[model samples]
Target: MYTYTEFDEAFVRNRVAQFRGQVNRRLDGSLTEDEFKPLRLMNGLYLQLHAYMLRVAIPYGTLNSGQMRQLAYLADKWDKGYGHFTTRQNIQYNWPKLGDVPDMLDALADVGMHAIQTSGNTIRNVTADHFAGAAADEIEDPRPVAELLRQWSTDHPEFQFLPRKFKIAVTGSPTDRAVTKAHDIGLRMVRNAAGEPGFEVIVGGGLGRTPMIGKVINEFLPKADLLPYCEAIVATYNLLGRRDNKYKARIKITVHENGLDTFRELVDARFAEIRGEFSGVDQKILAGIEAQFAPPPLRQAETTSFEVRYAADPVFRSWADTNLSAHKSADHAIVTVSIKKQGQTPGDATSDQMRLLADIAATHAYDELRISHEQNVILPHVHKSDLPAIYDALASVELATANVGLVSDIIACPGMDYCALATARSIPVAQTIATRFDELKLEHEIGPLKIKISGCINACGHHHVGHIGILGLDRAGVENYQITLGGDGTETAVIGERTGPGFAYDEIVPAIERLIGAYLNIRQSDDETFIETYRRLGMEPFKDALYGESARSGRAHAA
Candidate 1:
């Protein structure tokens, strides 16, 4: 949570004022819808299926209590009494009025936030690992570099109008939680032979209609060279990326068309050309940014209460087992508050829930919160001693779902429910799956399953990388759901393979059930997770479960 500097404050306020004027012009009919579209998109306003949506940037997915409270207030006042946390670690207000958007922007500026660079063919929000500073396996916190990129790329004149929207993600840990390999640029922190931590710069990674894992263009880049090296990559893409067709306009396609060797050569040449223009000023700034992320002071405290509760309360035990993660510090634990409760929307948090989260952050968790790419809120630094009380408070707000990596912890996009780009509905599908799994009582037993659903090919829900990837398509005026198996989003990233054909809306859930049931039978043991089982056995068993006569015979025999 870096507070805004004087320059940052002034810049955001000025942008809000400019947008206020643009909104007024549109209101007064001086600008038409087509004319206002691009201007408004630059500021993160989208014309969705039902109404205007405002996406607020959460840089590196970090938030302070005040900012979170303000978000709750905005949700209560402007739109409905809720906000949707997105896959990019941003929040979207889906029912914003055209005239009310300026006021919303001004409100966000009061707490060091805005919607700039969130949309419209530019470098979007710089996302990082949700458990960045706290993760036990981290080489170093990557948020400082993410913040530096945010400053460098925001309103950078050269990249403002690239061929398509660009995304960048950074992660400090060997385990990739930020979906780094699926961004335009993925920076994974690594230790060099000299034992100094640097970055493994990955280029041309993206997911949409075309999903591809990023390539390692640089085996190791010094910490000081991150910005310039990134600049070279984007600059190279801007020149060579296809603009003829929207589908082929992403950097992934550009890199595919040009080949990695040619792309690397071009980037290196550009890095040589523009490297001197940066000097050491960016590193100096990064030093200042690093100071802002100092770990919170934790006093020595007994974990007796937490241990006692874990033993006595099955409910609390279930939550602790699933929702908590290893922190670098013994006293602290990373708590992922699951917004995806059974039968609920995956990422939608009510104003009451948001306020409760903010209060808990302020009171116990060092006033810090994080939004995960999986669309869950994070209390990144809570003392283990305080787990019981925090769990109680979260339960009061219906957030203690205890299904962090379980089947119920699904990632889904707005889809046809609100997004005009969607060909099918994703919300109800997610809800049904979550609820169905819960009713079956097989969710926890299934073990570490990631089910991601996207309304369309844009992969907003990261369906391309889910262990069970569900993509909704419009097939001859019918809603057909396609399934992809063995997709992964971690260090070894892979796009899923599609099953033969799509299922009608009603058949999708049953198909998923059969697939999972088949997995349960085929797995070596309870410890064998869905992903490991898939890799070992391949997609044949799952395909048979979904579309084969043998699966039908098995089900009929069981009946």
Candidate 2:
């Protein structure tokens, strides 16, 4: 993790003081709600439907035991007893008082964390793969570049007031764990023919009312030109992007309105002009950042206990099979502590659970923790010898779920529950689906399925990229659930296709059940995952399953 210097500490403290003064002015009636809205947003505070929500950024999803403990403390002391981990790999407190947010910021600053640029139209948190340095197949660790971008974008004068919010993500592995395709600027670390590390820059990707997969603006941009190229892209968008309508204000909209070739030409021209301005300063910073992220020391340990437990205890075996990912080191495994336990909120972790996770990370996981974009906390480098102990500790806290990529492991947005922009409740729907699937005991059978639900078109839950995407809508004051099939957030990214008319809120779980059942029956073999089956056999079969023969005919006639 990148440690903050004395200058960084001073900068955060100054920002906190400024925000405190602004908050006092609002409380004293000097600034109305309208006048205070931008200020609060700049500080990552939002007034939700019933309470104030504070979003704290976890840059590149990396954290240490101390930072995790601070988050747990804040959850217990300042807000509700739990906090929600969001799809952006950030943590959100749904019920923070306006008066106490400054203290919250101060607490975050104490742990070398902050909520700055978490909201607003500026470049937000620079996210990377949760397994950035630990992934076995990574070309190189992406966090160094991610940190460089973070330092450059944070409080960049030219980009503070863009037409719409911009997001950037980086991934080092060939597999797209970061959902790079759905970001404003997605950088995939790739090696050129000459064996030089560079970025495959994709631009204009976004998901909201209008969803799009980013276009490859530059097939390969040298690592040294990263900052300048990124600046050029943002500058072009700043000048060309729409400001008249908030709906079309995103860079995705800009790219859609202008052809990719034209946009690429503009970006190339801009890059040419600004490329000289960087004189290798960003790369120098990146070198320093890379030194800070070197992998922790590995301890030699026996895995006989882990093997014995796996063989003797079916429960432990199930959890291990589901929760573990391959690590770069032979004796190490990446453990995902699933927050999506059955019937609970998808990403809500209690204060005690958070503290337990912190303890586990500190004691066993090299004191390193990662918040995954899938709403799970990751111990990126856990030795095989420590699996049983870690699992025991997690089980004692009721955190051992034995469901990581199964149907029960869903991604859900805080819909009508906390968000003012939501039209329907997403958490309840997610809970019901998970509980229903768990009751049927078919999660393992329905393997590697991603069911993402979003309350509205903002796509916070990334519904547009799930294998089974569910979008909640308001239909004449009633909740309507729309389903999209075959969507994926991987390297082969594709926006899901909608399956005819939507079901009511009550019918959604059953509809999902019917769809999965249909998939099981129609699939060629058990090995064929839901996404593979959807790809092998397109939307027609799923559509038939969702809307039966008569309903399909009625819909055809209506059309």
Candidate 3:
């Protein structure tokens, strides 16, 4: 984790002071609700359906024990007893009093954290692979580049008020865990012909009402040209992107309206115009940032204990199988603590659970923690020998659900329950699906599956990328659900295809069950996952299973 310098500290403190005054003014009637709206949004505060929600940025999803403890403290003291981790790897407190938000901001600042750029049209928190530093297959840690972007974009005058919110994601691994293709700007670290580490820059990708997999604008962007090139892209978008309609304001829309070739030409021209402005300053800063992210000390440890435990305990084995990933070090393992427990809100973590994770990280995980876009917590550097103890500690807090990539491990946005933009409920549907899957004891059998749900087309839950995507909608004053299949959020990014008509809220769980049941029967073998079968066989069979033979035949006849 990059420690905040004196300048960083001073800047955050000043911002906090400014926001505190704004909050005071709003409370004292000096500012109307409309007047306060943008100000509050700029500071990561949202007036939701029920209460104010505060979103705090966990930059690149990295945190230490102290920071985690502070988040836990804020959740317990000011808001509800739990906090919601979001798909952007940030955390949200759904029930905070308007007046207490300043205090919350101050408390966050105390731990070198803040809510700045967590909302609004400014560059939101720059995200990266949660397994960046620890993944075995990474060419380089992406966090340094992510941090460089965060520093460069924070309060950049040119981009402070863009046409719409901008998101950037970076991944150093060949396997794209960060959903890089679905971001406004995606950087996949790759070695060029000369074997120099550089980025394959993908632009214009986003998930919302119009979901798109980003197009590769630059096949090989030199490592040194990152900052200026990014500036060129954003600056071009700022000038060309739509301002008249919020619905079409995003850069993705701009890219869609103008052909990619034309957009590339514009970006190239802009890059040439402003590339001199950088003058190697950002590269220098990037070098310094890279130093801060060096891998932690590797300690040689025996994995015999872990092996013995795995052989002895079926329960521990189940959790380990789903929750652990390969680590860069032979003796270490990356542990993903599933926040999506069966029957619980997908990403809700109680204060105690947060504290417990903090303690576990401090003791067993080299004091490093990561929040995944999948709404899970990760201990990225746990020694294999510590697996049993860590598992036991996590189990105590009900964080030991062994469904990391399974059906029960879902990604859900704060839908109608909290979000003002949501037209239908998302959390309950996620909860019901997970609970039903768990009841069936079919999660493990189903193999790796990603089920993402969004309350609306905003796609905050990234339903567009899930293997089985569910979108909740309001139809004629009633909640309805829509399903999409074969969506993938990986190196081979593809938007999901919708399956026929929407289902009623009560019918959703059974519909999902029917779809999964159909998959199990139709798959080539148990080893062929839902996504594989969907990719090979396509949607016709799945549709038949979901809507039944009569309905499918009728729809075909109608078609």
Best by TM-score: 1
- Give the worst 10-residue stretch by lDDT in candidate 2: 550-559
State the C-alpha lDDT per candidate.
Answer: 0.93, 0.93, 0.92
- Candidate 1 vs candidate 2: the TM-score winner is 1
TM-score for predicted model 1 compared with the true structure: 0.99
Which stretches of candidate 1 lie above 4 Å from their native place? Answer: 553-559
Residue lDDT tens for model 2, 348-451:
99999999999999999999999999999999999999999999999998899999999988999999988999999999999999998888888998788999
What are the TM-scores, per candidate, against the unseen true structure? 0.99, 0.98, 0.98
Per-residue lDDT tens digits for candidate 1, residues 341-406, read 999999999999999999999998999999999999999999999999999999898999999999
Give per-candidate clash totals. 0, 0, 0
| Better candidate by TM-score, 1 or 3 | 1
Best by lDDT: 1
Runs of candidate 3 exceeding 4 Å displacement:
549-559
